[model samples]
Structure formats: C-alpha cells, structure tokens
Target: MQKLIRRREANPGVDWAEGGLHPLLARVYTGRGVAAPDELELGLGHLVLPDKLLHADRAAILLADALAADKHILIVGDYDADGATSTALAVSVLRDFGCRHVSYLVPNRFEYGYGLTPEIVELAITNGSPDIIVTVDNGISSIEGVAAARDAGIRTLITDHHLAGTTLPDAEVIVNPNQPGCEFPSKNLAGVGVIFYIMLALRAELRRRDWFAGRKEPNLSQYADLVALGTVADVVPLDRNNRILVAAGLQRIRKSQARPGIMALLEVASRSPHNVVASDLGFAVGPRINAAGRLDDISVGIECLLQHDHAAARALAAELHQKNQDRRLIEADMQQQALQLLDQITVETESAPVAMTLYQPDWHQGVIGILASRIKDRLHRPTIAFADGDAGEIKGSARSIPGIHIRDILDAVATRHPGMILKFGGHAMAAGLSIPRDAYAAFHDAFVAEVELHAEEVMLQAVIESDGELAPDDFNLELASALRFAGPWGQHFPEPVFDGVFDIINQRLVGEKHLKLVLSHPDSAQLLDVIAFNIDPQEWPNQTLSRVHLAYRLDVNEFRGRRSVQLVAEHLSAAE
Candidate 1:
C-alpha cells in the first residue's frame, strides 16, 4: 500500500499577494519553492543569459566562424525525442540563416547505439565528408568519437545537456550546461535548450559582424515551439529559466503560429493547437515522435518536424501516430511478460528485493527503458530490465525511486566488480548499462548489493505527497481551469493534487482497469464527476464502502464546446 502525506501548505504569502498573485496561487506557489510572484512570471525576458554557461560564448564563436566560412555542418543527434527535436531545430534554423550546407544524421539506435560513436562517425563520413560536426543532445561521453572526427579533419561542436563524464570530450567547443566548470544557474536545460542558447549566442556573434546587414535577420523565437516540445518531452525540471523557454514556446503553439510539424503532431493527437498545454507534449506528442525512434528510424520523426508542407507533415505525423499505437501494443505485451517473470521469482519467496533485476533475451532493446520505468512504478523499488545487445553483452535499462541514484549504483557495482559493466551512462533516476551474458549473475548480485547498501527504510516505501483536501469553495470550474492552463507545470513544478474524503455515490467500470464514479462531499449535497484510471479492480470492487479518502487532481474535461471540472483520483486510502 502507498502512503499519502499532506504537504504543509503555507498561507504566509502577503508579499506574493501584494505582487498581484491570486491568494490561492500564492500559497500554491510558495509551497512549491516559489517565493515571489515575479518568479511565476515566465516571460521571455526572464530567460538566463547564454554567456553564463561555461564555454557557451566560445562555442558560439566557433559555430559562427564555421558558418561564415560556408563549411559543411553535419549535425550528429541522439535517437530520441529530445534529439529529434534538437536536430530539427538545428537543421531548420541553419537553413533559415541561409546556410545551404547544413544537414543532420540520427544514428540508427540498433546499429550505432547512442552519441557520436566511432562507427557513427564513419557512417556520418560515408554519408558526407562534412567539414564540421555539430552534435545535438549527445556526444558528451563520446571520448573515441571526438578523436575520430578530429582525425578525419572535421571540427566538432557538442551542445549536450547530459551530465559530463570525469574526462571531457576533445571537441572544438563543448556547450553543455552541466559540464564541470559551468556556472549556468539552470543546469537542467534539455538538449534543445542548450542548442537554443547556442543559437542565441551565434546570433549575437553574427550581429557583431553585421551579417544581417543585407539579409533578413531570423527571429529565433520562431523556433521556441521546438524548444518547448523537446524540453517537456525530455522531462527536465522546469526551473525559472526553463519555464520561460517553455512558456514562450507554449504561447506560440496556442497562437497557432507553431511550426508545421508541431501542428501536424497536434492534429494526429486530436489536440487543438489553440489549447495545447505542456502535459500534451509529454503524454501525447512526445510518445508519437519517440515511437519512430523506438520502433524504427528517428529520421522519420525529424523529417516530420522538418517538413514545411502542411499535407506532407500531416502524412508523416499520421504514420508516426500509427507507429506509436504499435509501440503501445508492444509495450503492453512486454509489461505483462515482465510482470509474469517477476511473479515467478517472488512467488516462491513471497517477497521482493530492494533491488530487482530481470533479463529477457527476446526483449526489444529500444523499449527497455520504458519497460523498466513501468516495472519500477509497479514494484516501488529500483528495477532494471535487460535486453539482448550486440556481441555477447546484454543491455540493461534501469529506473529508480527518488532516493536511489541509479547511475551511482551502476558506478559502485562496476567499481566493486571489474570487467563486469562494459559501459553505462545515465542521470539520477534513469540509466543504461551493458553486461556480458555470462556475467549476468555476478552483475545482478553486485547491483543488488549496492542498492541494499544505499536503500533506506523510508526510501523503500512509496509516499505520495499531497496538498490537503480542498474546501467545497475551492472545488469549482474556475479554479480547475486556472490550475490547468495558468502556467506550464512539469517535473519539480507539479500540478496540484488535493486529498479529501468523499461519499461514493455511484461507481462503474468504464474501460479496462478504469473506474467512473459519482462522488459527493460528506457534508454537502453537491455531486462531482470522478474518473480513476488503472485502479486495481480488487481495490474498489462494486464500491461497497460508503465513503473513502482520495488523492486527486482537479481536471477540466472538455467535450465539444462544453467543459466541466472533474476529479482525477490518483490515489485512495481509508477515511480516518
């Protein structure tokens, strides 16, 4: 069972209220570390300066010089949504800047894996012997690839956001916000955001040279939509700086001034661009673009975003939509199989480990990350799911609870047992590694031991933090709508979820594992609509209980031209 802990909601927001923030918004903002009302003003003017990033200005000078010399710039991108959008943004923006020699190549994940690998560099060379290589969203950890590029007489500029390794790449210029000496306050920039900053710096460099003297200077804000899409899709924390970037992009999408590819994606997802929100990017748009990379080539997604023709964009978006559906079906089957495997292991012991690991040779390598995430959520433990990799190695994707630093655990395991982990890279909560097939047992033991060394009792249990029950006055369509569209919420800046006790007036199973119910306040006669998805049927069978406590978010459900406030119950517990 999950534990629900009420957040200590603060009401001492006099300064915030004086700054013209709504009273409710003030408390909500303060609860989430927002001290002043001005902090919530996510305008383009609020963005952090690009020069603050270490070496960013230098990187900009290098790129500007390359462009001035009319050097062939081949973009090397990772095969993911962030990489795809970053690649598209680079290609589109460079072309808009009147550079005809700009192009991109996203490595086939199955063949080349991630980053600008030596093989990928050769493939890039085979495709075209570009004079310069501009890596978007990758290449920070590519020690060999950078060397290979240099040997081939190609200059390199890497604009990545992933954490840098102990040793940096030998590139012409590196513009990662998370690099060792970077004092960039907002280090959580997505790859797209990093490139966007580089673009900003490049524009300043060009302006210094009077490059726009005879040409129309491209307003880079036009690419903000791509930045927003990639930022949200990558699930990066929406700091004040990231929020400004995302909000600017969201404004463009709402105004129907989004790129043709984004419009096409919205169309396929059945979302109106006029009403698109940040959540739509994560749940709807990101998945479709990711499907191409997971199931096929990421080039499809990049090409879809690059197309200026509305019809062509729509057609590619439709194909991408179908691929997403196929991905979902495959993911469902894999999840079920994973659960079965877990059952077999825990069935005998009747208990699960603090660190769980599973391997399936037939699993699709591209989908293992999502699979690991799902299983981690289910078990409420650090989990790793493995798939077959090239050679005799098995690639593993890992996901962890907030308390467990998965990448650290991998490093520890590798240190404790040498020649075990061939290679690994990732952030705090998610990571990827490869191990020899014959050493799976040793690797699993080392990994689990490291997790046990780090797992605390509090970390092992799942705790759902919630804002205490909303008053009847707070439960209205206005508040719901305001909360939904007031600003871009993601990662650290979460949408509000309130907890309360309600009388179960009526309940019925709608779709598989979903419950539709009519809920009523215990002391009020007013009725409310509630939809609980993926709820275990055994937990709310026939709704025999008269009342129950629920942790839910206020959602605005719209149909046709009508809209209503609905409660989306995320968690439930017995009433006190």
Candidate 2:
C-alpha cells in the first residue's frame, strides 16, 4: 500500500495569492523552500555570476592562451547527453570566439570505457595531436588518463561536475563546483553548465585582452538552450541558480531563438519549441541523444547538436529518433524479464524487500542504469542491476530511495568486504560498481545489509506525497496554464501534484495501453479529461468508475491547434 502525505508549508514573506501567484502554486513553492517572491525570478540577470566558481577564471586564461597561440585544442567528453551537449557547446563557442583548430573525442563505453582512459589518449594522439586537451563532464577520477596525456606532452584542463575521489587528477587547471574548497553557491551545475561558464569567463578574458579589437565577440547567451538541455537531462538538482539557467534557456527555446540542432530535435519529437517544458528536455530529447551514446558512438549525437544546417540536423535527429525507439524496445524487454526474476525472489523471501541486486548476463550494459531506476521506483527500495562486463565480471548500476544514500552504502559494503567490489563511484542517488560475476551473492548480501542499516523501515515502505486537494477555483484553464509556467520544475523542485475525488464519466483505452477518462469534479459541474499512460488493465476496469480520489497534475494538451486543459493522473485510489 502507498501512503500519501501533504507537504509542510513555509511562509515566503508575502501574500503569494495576492502577489500574482496562484494560491495552489504558492503553497507548492513555499513547501520547496522558496522564501520570497524574488526567488522565483528566473531572469538571466538573476543567474549567479561565473566568477563564483573556483578556477573558472584560470580555465578561461588557459583557453584564451591556446586560441591566441594557435594551439590545437581537443575536448575529451564522456558518452552521455551531458557530455554531448558540453562538447557541442565548447566546439561551437570556441569556433565563434576565433579558435580555428578545435575538435572533440568521446570514449566508446564498450572499448575505452568511461572518462579519459589511456587508450582514449592514444587514440586522441593519433587523430588530433593536440597541444592542449579539455575534459568535459569527465576526468575528475582519471589519474592515469591525465598522466598519459602529460606523458604525451599535452596540456590538460578539467571542467566537470561529478564529485571528486580521494586524489584529484594532475591537470593544469580544474573547475568543478563540487571540488574541495569551492564556494560556488550552486554546486549543482551540470557538466554542460560548467563548460558554459568557462566559455563565459573565456569571453571576458578575451575582451580584457582586446582580442576582439576589430571583430565582434559572439554572444554566448545563444548557447543557454543547450545548457538547459544538459542541465535537465543530467538530472541535477534544480537549485535556484540552475533554475535561472534553465528558465533563461526555456525562454530562448520558446522564442525560437534556440539553435538549429535543438530546433530539429523538437521537430523530430513533434514538440513545439514554443511549448517545450523541462520534462520534454529530460524525457524526449535527452533519451534520443543518450540513445546514440548507449547503443553506439556519441559522435552522432554531438554532430546533430553541432550541425548548423536545419535540414542536416533533421536528418541526424531522425536517426537519433530511430535509435531512441530501439532503446525503448530493449528497455521494455529487460524490464519484463527483471520483473520475472523479482517474482522468483519474492516467492523465496515471502517478505517485503528492503533492497535488490539483480543481474542478467545477456542484459545490455548501456540499459542497466535505466532498468535499475525502474526497479527502484517500483519496489521503493535501493536497487542494483548488473549487466555482463568483461569476462568473470559484471557492471552494476544502482538507484536509491530518498532516505538511503546509495554511494555511501556501496562504500561501506566495499570497506567491509575488500575486493568484493572492484571499483565504484557515484553521487547520493545513483552510482556505478564493478564486481566479479561469482561475487553476486556477497554483493547482494552486503547491499541489503547496508540499505537496512541506513534507512528506516518506514522509508522502505512505498509512500507518495501529495500537495493536498485542489480548491474549486483551481479547476480553470487560466490556473492550469499559470501553474505550468510557474517555474522550470525538476529534481529537488518537483512539479505540483494535487489529489481530489472525481467521478468517471467516460473511459476508454488509447494506444492499446493508456487509460483515457473524462472525470467530473467533486465540487463543480466541470468535466476534466485525463490520460493515464501504460496503466494495467486490471488496475483500471473498463466499466465506468465513480468516486475515486485521483492524484494528478494539471496539463495542457493540444490537438489540431486546439488547446484544452487535461489532468495527467498519477495515482488513483478509492475515496475514503
């Protein structure tokens, strides 16, 4: 059973309802730590300055010197959407700033693995023979890769956002908000955001040097859309600083001021840039870009983002769309098989699960992370899913509930059982690990014990938090549209969900899986349309239903140029 609780509210020092905020949304923002009306200001001017990030100015100087000296610059990027966007942003901004010879390389997850491996360095040497190498979204733990680059006489600068390990890399300069001693207010910048800041500082440095004496400095604000895409796709917390970046970026996308590549991606997904939301970035475009890196090289994704021609970008976007479809098919099959495995485990245990570690030799490594996340959501427990790695080893991806710090759990398990875990690193919610295939038993036991030790029994139980029932005044389209544009919601700052009893007027299935219903409001004569995607037939009957409390968010669904308010139902239970 799932428990529902209303979030606690805080005073934001104003009459929010009277200050142009919908009453429903005022409480929602207040619950999320907003203290005043100005906190919701998402204008670009409200963004935290780049200089607050440590080493940002130094990184700028390094890049400016390279451009002035006509040195070849190579960007080493990880194979993910954040890395793809970072590389694309760097390449685009550098070229625009008169850096004539600049290129990028992303390690193939299958061959070179992640980060700047020695093998990747060798490949980079053979391909570009760069004078300086810039690492984007990776290289925080790449001790050997930096060494290899140094040995090959290449200067290296590291710009990343991941938490650092015990020892830092020996790069010439490092700029990570999470790095030790950095007082950047927002440590939540995605890899792409970090690189974009560096670009901003680099532009300032160039201006200070009078490098643009005769030529105009390209406006770097044009790249904020890509920054927003990567920030949302990377799933970093939407702190106020990050919200500013995303809000500014969304404004550009909505204004059709986004780049050709971003525009093409929106086209392929059948999304209007004018109406694009943060969810669209994370769910639609992110997956398509990530699909290329997961199943193939990320060059295709980077090329798509870097392409200036609309037609060429569309061609690449189409290719990415096909890859995303293929990825979803693989993910669905794996999920089904995993559920079957879970059934066997449940049968053996006959008790509620606290945690789970599942492995299938044939499972795709690229997809295991997504699978782990799914299992964690369903079971409401810390979950680790392993895909076959090198011979005698497995690559495990983990996801955790709110109360459990997954990375700490892994560290403790590894500490207790040395060599049981070969290698691991990640943040609080997610992490990656490697272990011998034969060590699955020990790994599973250790993980379960650690999860139980760290999390309370109540946390293990499935619980859903609601923003409470909506008032009669909240049922209008004006309120729905206002709520939608309240702010760019993500991660820590969640979209609002409210519960209310509704009488089902008409119900039908759409696309063979979705439950589409017309609901009547409890306190009014208004009829609301709702769609619950991928709901089980058993959970929702074909017969018309009445008096069910629905936890849903307000949505605006458009069809054939006609726009109407729609309720996107998340959970439904019999009204008490």
Candidate 3:
C-alpha cells in the first residue's frame, strides 16, 4: 500500500503572524483552519459554558437531589480509558462534595460486554443496591438497561458522548451534546468530557443551594488532568473546547499537580511530569490504562485513578503496565495471522476488495479492535476483525477509512438483512457488532456491498496530509520546541508535518526496526539528524540511495541533558 502526500490548503486571509504566532506556527495553524486569534486561547474561561449542554442542569439537579437525600449513587462506566476516567471523575467529585455511599461498577468486556446491558444492571443490583444509577461514558443506547433500572425503582441519569440511536434511552435525564436539538457548540466531547461538564453543572447547583458553606468547593479545573487524559485517550477531535480542556490538564501535569494515578502512569512510561504533553498522555499513559480494560477488568484502571496513596497508585500502574505488555504480544500474533490471511486474498491494487473482513476463531477478543485498525491503515480500506464469541456468535470490531461512516454501514446492513447483525453501535470511524458464527460469510458479503455502495475511489487510497516544507531557518531548536508545544493536537487538529527532498549523507539501523540518518538539503550545507521509527526491515538503510523525499516532523531530541533539532520521518521515498 503506497501512500500519497497532500499538503493542507492554508487560509491566506487570516493574519496569523499579526496574532503574535511564530511565522512557521502561524502557517501550520492557518492550514488547520485557525481564522482568529481567540481560537488559540486555551484557558479554562474559554471553555464552552455548561449551561449550553442539553439536560446538564437537569442532570445536575438529579444528582444533587440524590446527594441531598443521602441516596445511594452508583456509577455505571464503560470498559475503556475514557470510561475509567469518567467513573473516577464522577466518584471523586461527588465524594468531594460530601456525598456518602458513592460507588461504581464497570462492566468487564469479556463477561458483560459494552454499555449498561440488562445483565450488567442485574450485576450492579447485586453488587450495590443503589437508589440512583449514574452512567458515565455510556448508556446513550442502553434502552433495556435503563428500563430495567427504572422498573427496579431506581433513577437513572445517562451521560454519554457517542452518537444516539433512533430511539433514545428512557433514563431520567440525558446529557449529551450530539442529542437531537442540542445547542452545545462542540459535539466532539468524549465520554469523559461529558461527565466533566455534568460535574461542573452539579457543582454550580450545589453552590446555588448553599451546600458549600461549610465544605470546601472542589476546583473542577484540578480534575482537568482526568479530562485531558480521557479526551486524548478516546481520540476525540481537538476542537477549541476540547483543546481548552487538554491544555488546562497539561498545565497541571507539567506542574506536577496531577492526580497520583496519572503521575504513577507517567512514571511507569518514563515520561517526566515536569514537561508532559498531550501526546505523552495519549501514547504513554492512555494505553497502559486502556490495557486494563482490554485484557482484564477496568477496575484496576479506575482504582488507580481514584487512589490517593502514591504507593497504591504505583502498584496499580505496574499491573496496568504488565497488561499492556501482554496486550502487545497478543496483538502482534493476531496481526501476523491477519497478514497471512490477507496474503491469501487478492493482492493486486485494482482487484482488491474495497473492504476487508478477517476472522480467526482463536483470536483474542480483547485485541480485535487494534488488529482491525492496523489492517485498515495498512490496506487503506474499511476493515473488521472478528473473534469467536458465546456459543454460536462471533464478535467483530470494525475500523473504517475516511468518507465511510462505519456505524451507518452497520446500520444499513442491520436494516436490510434484519437478523444478520445481532446488535451494533459506534461512531463514524469505528464500530462493533455480533452475528451468528455460521453467518460469517453472509455478513461479510453484506458488509462489503454496503461499503462499496458508499465508498468513493479516492476514499480507498491512503493519503498523508503535510504542512508543506520547512526552510533551513525553520530547522532550528526554537521553532521545533515552539511547534511541539503550540498544540495539544489530536484527531481533527493534527500535529504539523512537512515534506522535502534531502540528501542522505549517512544512514544506519538503530533499535532493530528504526532508521537513523544524517541528511542535508540540496541548497543548504547544514546537516540534520533524522530518525524514522518502525521502518521496513527488508528495505531500509539503502546504501545506493543518494537523495530521498521525506515527510517528517520537526522534533527536539534530548539526550544526556542535551537537546537538538531532529526530523522524525513519517514517510520516505526515492526522489528523482
């Protein structure tokens, strides 16, 4: 799968430099659609007011009432990083507000599956006969689960960020920006972000009721660390609102004011809290937390976040780190098997299917999502990886290329084929579903047809967007450091990448799969240090190549207390 590089179109009309942005950073931000200076402001005051989120006030009132009446409040959470953070955030904040009998239950992915299912509801009842059930990061589609709780004489408040279905859950109050007719400006809130907003509203409600006269008011901004981790971990778009949350969170972590769990996770990942960034959270800490949910129960992660003792948090972090290591081994094996399966199918560019679906009966259910994502990126097509489920069922995790709404495609398949898919729900780029084990072939064909019906030719082609090229002057440490921190970038707001032709002064292999190189521009004699990670072992360190075109990021590499500019190559190819 060869890729095409396309530079983003810059907005020339916006005077980014006039807004006090560095020339290089100004150009990068302009390419990402930053039209005004205020958009760059990431202070807590710039966050969208909680009043705009539909039913946030009502939900706050509900939770406040529960607290006022000393009712048992139980949080139903999903089994992912966002869910863990949301559950922890809700529990910590409510308890900080002096609410007694606050507990939570996260459904294990293996036994109870996702969301608040009826089985999970029964489990929750047996676990902690609660008076009010607060669902964080889930329950938007748990129609049956909410009904069960309602029939059990329990009140339910649903706070989720996933796309709502045709019929909303019958919970007592729902707080989601994507819900019908919601006026909240940003709809890209992760599950954790939704719960964060609800907590803020709850604080306000409590404040208005004079409930904080004798109690210390929890500064919700302090919890931004959790919000930041969840927002980046869930891979939500970094819209201005989300950027504010992430920026605030990064500020706290950088000052070492983050919670014990975050600090402990960072320590395990070898990231310094004094200079932590959004990517550090997304790549290093987030994965360790998510590994708990993937390989075991998510309670390990939630407990780590809620723990006030540093030693206990570190112990949980170590466990999560081990789980992550195990997940990597399992994922590597599954990916190899998937690659072997792909080799058996069409290999030609033109003849290959627009969508790919692979299944192995022995594949670990916890890792199918990652396998699907890897295949989707490798082949630049919508991909789904399936693993054996209960008795006669097979569970699939789907990852889609751009321009294809995977969840909608699943919906179409379910709408047309009726019983082929048992249940499905997700956002545009990813989804999950289940079907009879015997119906694998039929479901695969139906899925391919639906994808082909919706996919465009260009959509199937892998393309990398670049921020154009950098000049010799731009290859300095100041600009690199500025660009690095200029963004809490993720998803929609991408980090800056540039492409240019460079002379390969020297090349060598480092750390087995990475390539280290010294390169210089044709016009400039100054050589630049470059490194590309996870390169193809069979094709790298080509001694015959004199010049190459490289897509890379200007990064500052620090070694032995020394920092210098280094280009991190994302893609490289021979140049004419």
Model 3: per-residue Cα lDDT over 1-576, one tens digit each: 567899999888886656777877878888999988778988899889999999999999998998899999999998889999999999999999999899999988888889988898898889878999999888989999999999888889999998989999998999999999899999999999999999999999998999999878989998999999999999999999999999999999999999999999999999989878889989999999989998988999999999999999999999999999999999999999998998888555566798989999999998999999998888888999999988899999999988999999999999999999998999899899999999999999999999989988998878889999888888888898888888988999998999999999999999999999999998899999999998887889998899999999999998999999999998899886
Give the per-residue Cα lDDT of candidate 1 at 215: 95
lDDT values, one for every candidate: 0.87, 0.88, 0.92
Q: Is candidate 1 or candidate 2 better by lDDT?
A: 2
lDDT of 1 by residue, 366-433 (tens): 89989999888877888899999999999999999988999989988888888999988978888889
Candidate 2, after superposition: displacement of residue 41 in Å?
A: 1.4
Report how far residue 497 has shifted in candidate 2, in Å.
0.8
Worst 10 residues of 2 by lDDT: 1-10
The candidate that achieves the highest TM-score relative to the unseen native structure: 3
List the candidate 2 regions with Cα displacement exceeding 4 Å: 1-5, 8-13, 347-350, 542-545
**Best-first order by lDDT:** 3, 2, 1
| lDDT comparing candidate 1 with the true structure | 0.87
Pairs of residues at least 3 apart in sequence or in different chains that clash in candidate 2: none
Off by over 4 Å in 3: 348-350
